[model samples]
Target: MNQNKSGPGTSLVGWNIKSWLSASVNTLDDADLELVYCGSDVPSSQCLSLVKESIPAWQSRAVNFDEGDFFVLSGQQKPVVIMRAKSPTEAQKRDAGLLAPSAYGQARDLVGRAVSEVRKFKSQKVNLRFESCQDREILGALVGLELAAYSYKQSVAAQPAPFPALGLSVKAELKDEAQAIAMGTNIARHLVNSPPNLLYPQSFANAVVELFANVPGLSIDVWDEARLQKENMGLILGVGGGSENRPCMVHLRYRPEGKSEAPLALVGKGITFDCGGLDIKDPAGMRLMKKDMGGAAAAVGTLYWMTQSQFARPLDVYIPLAENAISGKSYRPGDILRAKNGMTVEIHNTDAEGRLVLADAMAVAGSQSGSDKPAAIMVVATLTGAIKIGLGSDVAGFFSTDEALGQVISKRSQEWGDLMWRMPLFDGYRSRLDTNVADINHCATGSYGGAITAALFLTEFAKGYPFSHMDIYAWTDGERGALREAGGSGQAVQCLAGVLQSFGL
Candidate 1:
């Protein structure tokens, strides 16, 4: 075993992290600042000797243990944490206060508690000691700690508080996949956390270029408003005309090594801010509009993950970047916009601008698919409040034109811990977008099945290609579980990444 060195640890923003297994413990000094997890009976272990000797008084309180309950033990310089580790069966029982349905929930919750204790004591470094845990479990805990430690501040001044350095007692092993996924998620969160003023269309495109600079097997192409106009993408131009920032489409391609099959195309909505254009939105409804580009964030994050993890596949992502704000130049309710595919759309509601931008983007992506490539198209967006009303805030509603693709997405979502529910495309609902003046209306007139109708509107641009659409809430309303907070959840990046990874296999 290699002797652990005390140095500047790798952190998400400010929190340092370390991982180890029980067998790697070489000294009692390592347990000087530690978190001990044991079952209700307190499993007997040699590592716990120091913890037991140091705090016999608090150890007695474990006579009647509750899940997630912990007791703090004082050390010479710092406090030691002793937490009750819930069994897998106990964690699965929802009534036991383990709200996260997965078995890994207990381990993740432990990290959350550790972060709190570290903050309370203002400790600069802490260690997590675990027994009989898998590598993924420990990785999940560390990922949780990194995420909980993240806080976005707009100040240029020095940071107010210190973030703790974490040490984990798990076998040093391959952590590339876990860390890459976490990094991707953090990328999405940082993008979503940025205020709209800093993340407008052109700037957002620049950010993607900067992020992918060091990454290999990637190519980026961005089209400004003029270029979009030249391509006759009137839908995108119409929606973004109100904002001075201009509208753009960014194409990121992941070129595979050697001979590979057709690419899987991903389309994400990049509305930097949705002021609801001429239709306008309520103040309360517009407060969180900074996350309007969450779908784009997710797509970017997934690409980050695949590239960082070196997943072998040819992939293409199309992101339509814009800000749906109100101004004299904004498209109004009665305007007809033409898509890149030469199809005309009547704008009944300017608030339904997401689908409009996506329409042109889908056309751009779908047009690239042919007999030689046979690419599959998938669209991700925060398209409607109706999805939130139907599936609530935590779950995303997805619709797919192809059944096999839908099943693969659903399976991957569940496996990756991303919650998704499949919604019906309902070809019968296509008429909801009918308009006398144009080929289609931007939105359905009636209130019912708005999510369905919005998805149905995209199929016209897809042009009978195999496509899947995910309408994600993209922000957590309350605490859900590990790596999830009230801010940007980076919703379906994991699910999308997983599907592409598995499909390639």
Candidate 2:
């Protein structure tokens, strides 16, 4: 975007990154901000603090925040969390046909609408306004940018040249911390957008380890197909049987301090490309199956975010990456298979393999991640077609027995303008997944509640944990919307990061 007081774009920037972070830092002012383009080599802090500061400093005094150009996240305060500034005036003008007063309110309206669009898979490039407002406005919009970047792309090299990178003028706090978060998110964008052919199970685990090598107190363990078999992850082994490339279960542990009271476990479904096994999809249906592992990508994003920042609590994340391909060895329908959970699932549909592999990972985390009773295990995935039909691509479907926990996730997502809809885990839905010959069917009994049935299948595996499942259609588009882009978007990363930062969990 030109800086001619009235331009139509966004700019991003970065610092020496290392220099900005080396010194013990706290507090940031407007002077610390930089101006670069998104997707540029620019760097920023990996924590929430950096994202907070960038909003107001870049808007040139038009947008404001709750306190200053940036403010510390309320409820749980460790350091200051800067916000992006947004201009309701500029926003309304850009919206042209909008009907709202106050730039912030208009901002709320526009960004929210764009978020809805992105969720629906209607738009890809999400553009929001950030002005000289204190800081919240711009920060919030930037957060939206992060959310928009979550969709899986074939590869970063194939993606648009790059987004304009912007800098946050900070008061005193080390700006690199904030930029680090951006850097991490940007890297996540690259990882998720990569094609399945290049980013297989082991390679994907390698990427995770490589990304966080700099962070202290983080460890990663990757189990190849051999180890998984020996360890009794038959479900995972069975699903990966058809692939020429062996499957892998990657474990990343982030231990901050003292024994965790309730260390959270994040389980992501990493089906790099879902061929639907024997139950193959048509041409259009399988077009974007490469992004099947979006759930695992989000998990990777979350782990990286927490690692980059110094936060309390223990965090353990599991990513099960595999290509659910068809092969001679692929488990055939009607084949009764045993899992790490000791339960046998009669293969009703090989296409419904995400929940199968995820079951093993959840069990591994159950034995690991350090939680006895129930840990806050958030499982993310582009799970079912039913989700697309029920919530569409615009809204991520959330299923959790713990209403409070689900509410927190939803609220933070809403704040960032990521659309999330909570669906009921009605017991009646389970009947749809009942299998005549097996303990339970891999898929729902009928197409009537596809999304719910998938969630229901996952529930059986997550029974031991306080699990919250997000059935993201991973597609976007629909009626009168906010954003208008149609490509791989990096969505939901911000909301997850925001919630983690806000709750300091």
Candidate 3:
């Protein structure tokens, strides 16, 4: 299955992330427009003054300005946005509150609306003004503004219009890390939005190599079909049998100058285009299948930030990339495939291919940790629609065997505004994967608990380690405040990065 590798020659030609967007700190007086936050208890006079009396009477009512509400004032020379924030007493309670999961979520949504409003005027520069807000809150607002500014126009013909260059007006102390997180998210969005024709398995691997070419303490190795066969990755090879592009297992290692401890293992599911193999999907269902690799996009995007920030500990990232196309060689349902971990799986449905590829990747990640046994193993994937049905598209669902590790991940997700809900490992659901033949079935016979079954399947490979599986919908059907728009949302980038930093990694 030797195919011509068509992409840049060892250099990051199309992957250069520098020219995408830029952010800077400046004073409020020099800004082209202004954005302000008002608490729920703010006086009627203050609310009226913030919008410059341009809004209609009904729109300008004090009661209308509640937490997370947004209003625009366009009559003035410079447009101003007044967003309602938590009341002072509520803020104080949340600062020391035992349970306030919505604290950062409200801040993120409020800033997202402001970014959307600013974009309407095509203003390149913005002034963010919030009275008595903590530095962490400011950081969250900056992250939202930077991420909302992303627009992908790489394939336009004559000339697609360019997004207005974005600049931020804030104190100098709020410039660095916030910009890094935004840049990382934008990278994920760009990769996810790339055409599947240009971003095949091998091309995607090459892009990673080029993107991190000169990055210190970073090394990348890509295992092609031949090497995969030698290593007993039958599930990976079988799932990729229909495509000439072939599948590849990409390993990214990040070891800083003085770090020698075993790194945290992160695995991502990277199905470039999932046509469902012999069990082909409907034309409508297959439209956005190109985004199947979103899990891998988020993993690499998080690595980009970790390496750039020189995270304290090392990390190992494994991405199993392939295209599930249609051909005579396509794998069929009822076909039994053996994974690298020596587990035999009966394929109940060819469409359930993401877990197959991830099975081999997870085994590889687990083995790579050697005897140290990684502190935690986390896998991210767009693996199930059941999760969307259960949690909706706004939040990702995660499953973890370790309660302490799960709590840490949950808290960090809320703090970063990533919105992750912890689904149970539910050992009771383990028997749902029973099969008449082979060690287990690839998927459950019925649609119930698809998300849980998928996580249960993956857990078999993550032996002797604390594991967490994240099922995310990386594509947003529509805008949610300012944090995400109608395209690739880069769902788990911030959450994973926040988790790593929380572990002091």
Candidate 4:
């Protein structure tokens, strides 16, 4: 839990990133391993000429190498890895609007897989150089390397012997930006991977405080049970009443000097554990409930990135922390609760508790007045399984009240390699949430279009502000490409960072 340490006993802190300008491989510093990426457009002979001494077998094989193919040569002064990556086609480059399209995703995946392979050979210190790559591609490659190097063994009983201090030297720029984004992603991953017992509401709030204790121009405020009661946040209290840990809210504001633009508001659902409340879930359904707070982790990561990068605009982050456990005090189906906005909601199903907590946080986010009013509001949560069924586990589905804002977010998501598709906020399904007993129902009457209905439920609290909601899976079922493990995917941090950059100005 100590944020400063780096080793197997703790989460992977970060890498020692060094910048290099020399393109020649022979001029590179000596390391245990060297990774070189060869683009499809580059000739095999041109790549082979970079190395002073070459293995005949590797050179022969490189001639026929296909995209995604790689070869390794060991037993020399230092091991050398050669990976073949495809460059963007003319049409792809034209669509991207970059003179030199980065092929950011392809570079990221290739570098990540190459790093994973070399690590198996016990190579710690590594050097990377790319052929025919621009700064964007280099940024992607650096992010990929940083992500692949992450090793989380916090729960291991006997910590494995620490490897030599891992370091990476790349012949590129953007070290600061790449490191900031990657570290933000790893921070989110670490928080999501933590067990529930160690990360309840109070502990989660404390961790956020500790993490941002030294951040300049940032102020953090936490609301305890008394403050929740004073503010009449009955929806949050109702969802967290079953647990002894109690529920709370954390608000973070980052306002740098000479910045008078409206602040961007971010809201995240911080359900530390979701056991489905009184309705309860089957064992299989409850196994990975600890990751229910993945949205909060993403929000935390985004804030960290924005502050570290010194973004031009002010920002506000609201996190509602709670646990939906089973106990005598747990809120049950058909219960009526009042939100911070004074809207009555009838809970039709206890399993749908994520929306209950997020609604109150969104209400607070949209309540800012005067010059302090938020320019826009964005909410992220793992609120419904219907999203997973509709978009699958790999893609996140989003809904927005403003069309222009939604289009910009969609475009940014594609550029950042965070796949997000826009879902319709069908007014036809709004009727499903109507109930005779209350102003509205927290959940829809039936299962069809559940994700749309969930988005509708939160829209009622948006206060007419430009609002966007992202429903993400947040957990990767298996390792693939840049995702080195089957754990927290860190789904929306990068995309949200892009969103802020697009609108924060």
Off by over 4 Å in 3: 1-25, 28-30, 38-64, 86-103, 154-173, 369-373
lDDT for each residue of candidate 2 in 1-505, tens digit (9 for 90 to 100): 1122321112111111121122322222322222211111112232233344444443333323432223322212122123333323455344232221332222333343344333443322222223334344433333333333333332223343233222333332223333334444444444555677787777777766665554555677889888898888988888989998789988877676575566677788888888889988888888878778777877775665565544445777888888888889887888888888788888888989999998888877776532533366778888888877766676678888776777777666665555576788888877777777878778765558777877878888877667788876543442222223343333455566766665533
**Which residue pairs in model 4 clash with each other?**
none
List TM-scores for all candidates, in order: 0.84, 0.70, 0.87, 0.88
| Model 2 regions more than 4 Å off | 1-132, 141-168, 171-181, 310-312, 369-374, 475-485, 502-505
- Can you tell me which runs of candidate 1 are displaced by over 4 Å? 1-32, 37-54, 63-100, 104-106, 154-162, 169-173, 369-374, 478-480, 483-485
Looking at candidate 1, what is the lDDT of residue 58? 58
RMSD (Å) per prediction: 5.5, 11.9, 5.5, 4.7
| Candidate order, TM-score descending | 4, 3, 1, 2
Best by TM-score: 4
Q: With candidate 4 superimposed using the best TM-score fit, by how many Å does residue 271's alpha carbon deviate from the native?
A: 0.3
lDDT of 3 by residue, 145-188 (tens): 66665556532223544544444455654555666676777777
Clashing pairs in 3: 112-482
- Computed on alpha carbons, the lDDT of every model, listed in order, comes to 0.73, 0.58, 0.76, 0.78
Q: What is the alpha-carbon lDDT for the whole of candidate 2?
A: 0.58
Give the higher-lDDT candidate: 2 or 4: 4
